[model samples]
Target: MPEALAILQKYWQHDTFRSLQKEIIDSVLSGHDTFALMPTGGGKSICFQVPALMNEGICLVVSPLVALMKDQVANLQNRGIKGIALTGGIKQDEIIDLLDNCQYGNYKFLYVSPERLQSDWILDRIKNLSINLITIDEAHCVSQWGHDFRPAYLKISELKKHFPKIPFLALTATATPRVKEDIITELGMHNPVQFEKSFARKNIAYMVFEVEDKLFKIEQILKKNPQPSIIYVRNRKSCLEISSQLQTLGFKATFYHGGLTSREKDKNMQLWMEEKAQVIVATNAFGMGIDKPNVKTVIHIQLPENIENYYQEAGRSGRNGEKAFAVLLTSPSDSIQAESQFINVLPDKAFLMSMYNKLCNYLQIAYGEGINEEFTFNLNHFCHKYGFPTLKTYNAIQFLDGQGIITFLKEFSEKITLQFLIPSKEVIRYTSLNPNDEEIILTILRTYPGIYEIQAAFNLPLIAKKSHHSEAEILAVLHKLNEKGIIDYHSKNNDAVLIFNEIREDERTINKVSKHLIRQNELKKEQLQSVLNYVAEKNTCKSKMILNYFGEKATTNCGICSYCITQAKPKKDFSTLSNKIMALLQNEDLSSREIQNKTKNTADDVIFVLQQLLEDNFLIIQNNNKYTLKT
Candidate 1:
């Protein structure tokens, strides 16, 4: 076996490489700068991982998300391959220890966020490590034209100055032609070898439907497919409501959203992964770094903000090379709603300046004195106090974070600690009286061995699972204990944290990056328009449209899409369609849906014929909104 194949079999337990995997690996092994443009499920990680394993020293990976970094590190460690991630919320001393492990403890991978590279201390430490290769995940972020542009990514090329001889590998799931050019130029790749897998999934059918009742359509689709599936919603409320509704309708369903505690998210995800639940309703936070091969369908009930996000989400299905469906359900009001949610909330230069000033005031930071200061931020309370709109303010903060003016970490959970105040015998007696709390109290005591001697933080979800209770119930018991002076409990909830990277110059800070901000807003508008056009388009094949958007020209129509199916049917003359519609109404008054069902014609053709009939005075609508022959 090839050395790469041997490494893959040992670590990943796979025999063969997917399409373009071997070629990309070979390019990297040959010591050339490589760029791999694979789709969401194309096994991009293996392209760099296998070759790095074959090399002598550790591979340094720079990624954008903390969760993604931690997940990759955990997976590597599970395979008995040592790895470390320098993610957010780590203290200086802990970072030193992790970096030491990377340098001397025989670690194979070191994953860090792009922002971490800016620290001189970290760069100096990294300079001393025996680096073999540098991998940049989500490489499109280096491009300003990319859907998710980050200024931190632009600084990644600085690593070349330190590791000039080490080969660089850049990987991304989706990128446009412009973004591709930008990545190459910005990273300063030295004559890189580029490998791009076609963005078309032949096994997955892309279907779009315009319907009046989205829930009814969703039910019909789920009932027909009846396999493991995912339904993507736009908010936490929708995740809960849809999952509950599906459960009530006799389907094993669960939900996930950003608001869910870590334990809740893990429990719900486990149910879906183990196939105990038939469907998972979730917001966009659910699918990153997740690969489930048997997913037969992925349904989006609303229009996605952009085609890049939509394609990546829809591409999550049919990974097993089996027939699957990517269904998009849109109502008449969806276009307006999508525009309001995505486009209108984009922050312009004026809004950014105002938001920055308001944020400093909210955090009580004085001008030119608040550099390097961090504070807990509650977005809802801040917005309420200042009478500012929530969504726009959130977008402005995100823009500032991307610009490197500040660091905004959302959904930041604070530490929860507890310690026993009474003696062990007294606690046992109290628990015996409250038998309901006995299991949880004992489980916590067992899990944290030092709880009796000192305050210790515990995993609420793990205790809930061990004691057979919900997190809320566990919290209630703890509260009761604390109120009775049996234990000292402390907990805090901060929605986000803001770290000011620069001193407060307010308007001057905004002025430095105003041009880039305006350009980014324009890019967002253009991306939104592309999604709208994709939804409104009916003549072209959906798969071909996506390919064309990504700079690939696909000539053949995918026969499985809704547009192709409609085109493949035998075309009926206008008179034939009109006659069929008229015949359906002659039996009794019928709605458009009934006419389309009886006539077995496409909805567009039926609607066109119905309009002609109505205009010709051959059909009349009654008070019930049903059509009939003119009297």
Candidate 2:
């Protein structure tokens, strides 16, 4: 147990664990099933990672997001630790090889998507491995009570049957008490030790402004802060539209969404990360695994469907312990839009069954024939071909996903592979003959080994930067190499993958999960109503309200929140202050603070009066600070 701290300091370069992180790790090390409810950025990974490094056997991490697992595995690899991830997009041979490496190659961690656990072959191989810890990331997804429940997560408990002795750790950024109990029960966790950190992010000042002009409010926020920020919108179109508007306002901005290609996503993220762009306009897809610590503001252009989602998204700010703002900009129609987006559009049981049938027909899968099969799904194409509304159809698929009839695996960025056809000696000779292509050829030869024999994953943007060329130029060179028989290139960029969990089920089978769908939709509407109530709430302290929702008792008001600051205090009346201000400013100009001293009134009252005076043409603001008679 003493060596655990050494391992953490050695690998993570940290002096000590965050609050409760060490305790959670110690509980797991002592072989207890653990459920950790750490807020986002609360060092949840360390709870499992440190213990994995200290223990003898490999730690199996089951996560829902492929990109997140890939990023973590790559980070581990960079730290000289061996790790592999198995997701839908991985090739079969690659999976075999990766599993083999985990079994014999001293791999400390193996990350797998929950859907991949359905494979009997994978289970068979996993049973043979000496597993020590089973960690489930986003464990909330397993519970029907959770906001993002996925039915495939239920299969995680199956691993317990195979390895009865292995300890399990389930973690999520946000989970209500009901969801917590469900995770514990569904995972078959026996008296698991639970650890929860306070969900309050004191550094983030939660704000909600019901504004008529969202863009104008956004502009004001950006201009006031002007630090690295993220602006979250509802859809891809808004991502682009808002980003362009910000650019038009003379701010350096970029947009990201699930619709963009992997290369484009990476390029745009890099631009923001490197400070080339001051703001990133994006959908909710943009925040996971993004570690930009200096973000000063996170503004939501629309309300999220639930408080859990909103809290997690807003928590992305102020990671470096600096004061930051999380502001939600709401229009009159935002509540209506949110209801339509999340609640009203949720397909009923009939729609779910019909969509399921249509999906089976669309994929040409006969009843009892498509179990455990994976397909390249184009939702837009499917909707257009069948005359289904895209949003409703997608939501129905999501409903189906939660019911375990199908697994909706989102898009994962694929790796590009290149294999050389020309011999090594011939490559040098060709480069000498073709000086223009010399840098790229030399770079490929230097960076990727055995390219002449087998395809190796290559990063196009990385290679371009190394060779001091553009990605387009490097791609052109690769294409030229292919044409000249110098190399064979395979770029593996593709859309989301859908896997059928059961054979095409009839109405009876689909109806079993229909109740779950109805319950889920009902819970979603309840959550939406809660958010609307929070937005419309004017008396409660903002921080206290949010903290209470997460089951924390917040006794003291967060005095800095917008609500606390705006709450009327006992003081001189506003009209009196307004008249005093006008009399004070009749002859000489004065700044706000000067006026405040002269009037001996509360600062809020003075400021309120000043604003009314300016609005009513009783005074004029000049030089950005002084106020005088309007005359």
Candidate 3:
């Protein structure tokens, strides 16, 4: 073990293991099923990585996020470790070659998405490989009790049967006690070690602002703290608009959402990380794998779906163990809009079925006929063709996705649409001179007939099948032509790529939509509303409200919250210091330190009385800072 630690340090440059990382790794090394619940930044990867190196056979890691796995694999390779990942984007031959490498080469780790577990070839390959350990990242997806539940995860539990004796390590960041049990039962782990970490962060000061003018409140937050911050919005267009608005306000800001191209998203993120952009106006897509430790604030413009997401996102701040603020800017109008959006989200089964059927018709396929078919389902194009509200209809489709009807990550897949930019005679002349590639030239001509006069890029896979070459080989040939100025190809690979915005399902069939699923979504909206309510019903300690949401039994008021600081302390004798202060600023928000300076009292004494007044519901904080007597 000491030798193992020394090697880990020498290779990875980490001095020691984080909390429970050693225990989890040791359990797996001893061939025990391990269920690890490490908080974000608790170092979950090392738990599997160390044992994987010590194990006799390849460690197969089943994951959900393909881009994250790829990033990790790239980092591993940088550290001289051989790791491979299998996702939908990779060609079948490429995946086969990777599996072969695991079996024959010195590869010790293989990361694959849970969706790939559905493939017959993948299961067969796993049965053949000397796979000794299986690690499930984000294992909460397998449990219906979890917040981010996915039906594809159900397929992963079956892997236990394929390699009966292989040690299984299930890991997640945020799971309730119920979710924890569901993970254990779903994975059939016996007496697994439960390494639960506290969700509490003393360094983060949770503040909920009750504001009619959220923009004004945002301006105040920036003016007061003005450090590197993340502004989380709900939609893609909002990301752009908000970032633009912030830029207009003289703050260096950039937007990041799931909808952007991989290059654009990565560029924006790197800019933010490098401080080229001091503030990131992002949707929920900004924080994963973010190592910036000094993010001073995380401001939510609307609301998150649940506390788990809120906590994780907010936790991105104060990672450097410095004081940070997690603020929520909520309004009654925002709440109404959020609720309205939720209510309008349920898709009628018949409508969904009709849409799916239309999609199949457009793609020229029968029911269940296009099993592995992939297409660019442009919402604007589809909505234009069908005459439906693009946003609302698309959200309904997303709801269907949430119902386990389909796999939808809400991102785009960049694919090749090969169209020739020249005449057939010209192409033939070029191919004649380039006879070494006559096969691809002839293949393209045979597959995409009249490509020289085409408008749309021909489907590479469709062309590949017609050409009798693998997708990669076909792509390579196309790339050469593109490089030689004969054709053009586009690659749209992105981490936050949408798998299936809505799976091609029989939408017309009336099925029991999981109330559990809807409830999960509803919880997210409710979480947002809670922040709204906290801000609106001010004079309460904002940090205290946030802590309670994470199931903290403590009710001790966070006196430092905007609400507590603004509202004057209530009079104990019906004529105390709070009463006098309230009389002075009856309809205003008072800065606590400023008020303290005026009152000539200690911070604690002022906070205590203000908190008492807030508890007594004597006043409410509003807008940016001050408080008003409750009517």
RMSD of each: 3.8, 7.5, 9.0
Worst 10 residues of 1 by lDDT: 209-218
On TM-score, the leading prediction is: 1
Per-residue CA lDDT of model 3 for 361-426, tens digit only, reads 765666555554454456666678887666666755565454434444545656556667777788
Kindly provide the TM-score of model 1 when superposed on the true structure, using C-alpha atoms.
0.89
User: Please, what are the lDDT tens digits per residue for candidate 1 over residues 366-427?
Assistant: 98978768888899999999888999998999888887788887764756899999999998
> Is candidate 1 or 3 superior in TM-score?
1
* Model 2 agreement with the true structure over 209-277: per-residue lDDT tens digits: 765457877887899898999999999999989999999999999999988877799899999999999
Model 2's alpha-carbon lDDT is: 0.86
Model 3 CA deviation exceeding 4 Å by range? 1-4, 348-351, 396-552, 555-560, 563-631
lDDT, each prediction? 0.89, 0.86, 0.72
Clash pairs (backbone) in predicted model 1: none
- Candidate 1 Cα deviation (angstroms), residue 16: 1.0
lDDT of 1: 0.89
lDDT score for residue 525 of model 3: 58
